[model samples]
Each structure stands twice: as C-alpha cells, then as structure tokens.
Target: MWVFWALLAAISAALVIVLTKAGLKNIDSSLAFAIQSVMILVITWGVVFFQGNFHEWRAIEKNAWVFLIAAGVFTTLSTLFSYKALSQGPASVVVTLERSSLVIAIILSVIFLKEKLTWQVIVGGSVMIAGAVLISLSNSRD
Candidate 1:
C-alpha cells in the first residue's frame, strides 16, 4: 500500500513538473508558485475539514508543531528554488537535479530518524546522485 501511494506521488510530481514548466513560459516563477500554493492550501484544508481532522491540529504537541512548521518552511524554499530552476532550464535536467534530494533525504533519515542503512540504499543513492550529475553536465554541453 505504501509503495502504491509512493508511486502515485511520483507520478503526480512528474505531472507537476511538466505542467509547471509549461505554465511558467510567460509568468514569473515566483508568481506561478504562489498561485499553486494557494490552490494547495485550499485543497489540503478542504480535505482536512471534509475528514473532520481540522480540529486534530489542537492535539499536536509542541515538538510536532515545531517540526511541522520547519518542514513547511523548507518545503516552501524547495518549491521556490525548483520553480526558479524549472523556469530557466529544461524540465528533464532541472528535475533530474532536483531528484538528487533523494540522497540527502536518505542520509538525514538514517541520522535523524534512526532508519536502517543498508548497502543497497547507499549504492542506489550514490548511483542516483551520479546520474543526476551526469544528466546535468550533459545538458550544459548542449
């Protein structure tokens, strides 16, 4: 089930990259991101309200709130940077570089979340970063 959800998220992200690139042709990346952020806020809150989870926010602990707020800030930064990159570069190249975050996420997960670090994960992340670098370099030559 988790794998299914992950795959769905991946697909949705792909769509977002393509659609956002197309939409940014005439718009400033920051403005485009802001427009999309508004939609995200509305849709997410709508879901929470529909599910009767809007009041659950009061139950969140201080630490959880801190982490969530920090995550939100980082998420905004990440999206803004990605949008700027996408506006200036090819989608394929920008996305490949952005996907390198997987390696950083794995490292942080192991250190902060106490997640198991397997050889396969290490090798896979290394290969992924290498591939992203290769793709980015190749794009630069063209």
Candidate 2:
C-alpha cells in the first residue's frame, strides 16, 4: 500500500513539474507559487473536512504541530525555489536536480533521526546524486 502511494506521489510530482513549467510562462514564479499554494491549502483542508478528518487536528500533539509547521516552512521554501528553477530551466533537468533531495533526506535521517545506514542506502544515495549531477550538467556545452 505504501509503495502504491509512493508511486502515485511520484506520478503526481512529475505532472506538477510539467504543468507548473507550462503555467509559469511570462509569470512571476513567486506569485505563481502563491496561487498554487492557496489551491493546495484549500483542497487539502476541503478533503480533510469531507473525510471527517478535521476532528483529528484537535488530537494532534503540540510537538507534532511544531514539527509539521517546521516541515511546512521547509516545503514552502523548497517549492518556491523549485518553481523558480522550473521557470528558468528545462523541466527534465530541474526536476531531476530537485528530486535529488532524496539523498539529503537519507543523510539527514541517518544523522538527526538516528536511523541506521546500510550499504544499500549509502550506495543508492550516491548513485542518485551522481545521476542528478549528470542531469544538471547536460546542456552545458562550450
């Protein structure tokens, strides 16, 4: 089930890249992101209410709220930066670079979350970073 959700997320993220790139033509990236952010907030909360999940907000702990808020801040920055990049660069290259944050997340989890790192994780992350670097360098010819 988790794998299914992860695959769905990957598909949706790819669409977001292409759609956002197309929609950003001649538009200010920050303003474009603001509009999308509003839509995201509204739709997410609407679904929460529809699913009777709004009540779960009351049971959320203060620590959970704190972390979630912090995560939201990072996510906003990430989206803004990525949106700006998408507007300025090729979608394939930019999205590849953006998705390389997976490497950072793995390292951060090992450090901050005290997660154990296996050989597979280290090797996989290194390979992903290498791929991102390759994509980033793709159109840079003299």
Candidate 3:
C-alpha cells in the first residue's frame, strides 16, 4: 500500500511540473504560485479535518513545527527561484535542475539528519548534478 501511494505521488508530482511549465507560458508566475499555495493549503487542511487529525496539531512537537515552518519557507523560496529559472531557460533544462532537489535533499539529510555518506550516494548525486548541467548545455547548443 505504501509503495502504491509512493508511486502515485511520484506520478502526480511529474504531472504537476509539466503542467506548471505549460501554465507559466501564459501567466505571471508569482500569481500562479500564490493561487497554487492557497489551493494546496486548503486541500491539505481539508484532508486533515476529514481524517479527524486537525486536533492532532495541538499534539505536534515544537521541534516538528519548527522544522515544518522552515520547510514551508524553503519551499516558497525554491518555487520562486524555479519559476525564475523556467522563465529564463528552456523548460527541459529548467525542469531537470528543479528535479535535482533530490540531490540537494540527500546532502541536507547528511548534514542535518546525520545520515551516513555512502559512496553510492555521492556517485549517484554527482551523476544527477552532471545530468542537470548537461541538459542546460544541450539547451544552449540547440
């Protein structure tokens, strides 16, 4: 069940990126982001309410809330940067760099969460970063 949910989440995220790129062609990215943030927050809170989990917010640890708030701020700033990138760069290259958040996330996890640094992770992250650079270069060549 978890695997199914994870797969669906991945698919939905891909669709979101593609749709965001297409939508940005016709609208102000800031306005789009504002609307998306409101819609997502409402929908997320609705789910929490439906699951009778809204009350659980009171039980959330202070450290968790701190992390969540920091994450939310980071997400907003990241999206703005991404929108700027999409506006200036080809969608293919912009999308590739945006998705490189995985590599960034791994590095953050190692630093903040104290995750072990394995050779596989370093190699994989390096390759993914290289791919982003290559995609950007390819766009310039076209």
Highest-scoring model, TM-score: 1
| Global lDDT of model 1 | 0.96
Q: Candidate 2 has which clashing residue pairs, if any?
A: none
Question: Candidate 3 vs. truth: CA RMSD?
Answer: 1.6
Give, for candidate 3, the lowest lDDT window spanning 10 residues.
Answer: 83-92
**TM-score on alpha carbons, each prediction:** 0.97, 0.95, 0.89
Candidate order, lDDT descending: 1, 2, 3
lDDT (Cα, tens digit) per residue for candidate 2, span 1-142: 9999999999999999999999999999999999998999899999988898787888999999999999999999999999999898899888888889999999899999999999999899999999988877875541
| C-alpha RMSD of candidate 2 | 1.2
Local accuracy of candidate 3 as per-residue lDDT tens digits, 5-76 = 999999997787777878888788888788788989999998988998787888999999999999899989
Candidate 2 error regions (>4 Å): none
| Model 1 per-residue lDDT at 105 | 97
Which scores higher on lDDT, 1 or 2?
1
Off by over 4 Å in 1: none
Task: Please give the CA lDDT of all the candidate structures.
Answer: 0.96, 0.92, 0.86
lDDT of 3: 0.86
The total number of steric clashes, by the backbone 3 Å criterion, in model 2 comes to 0
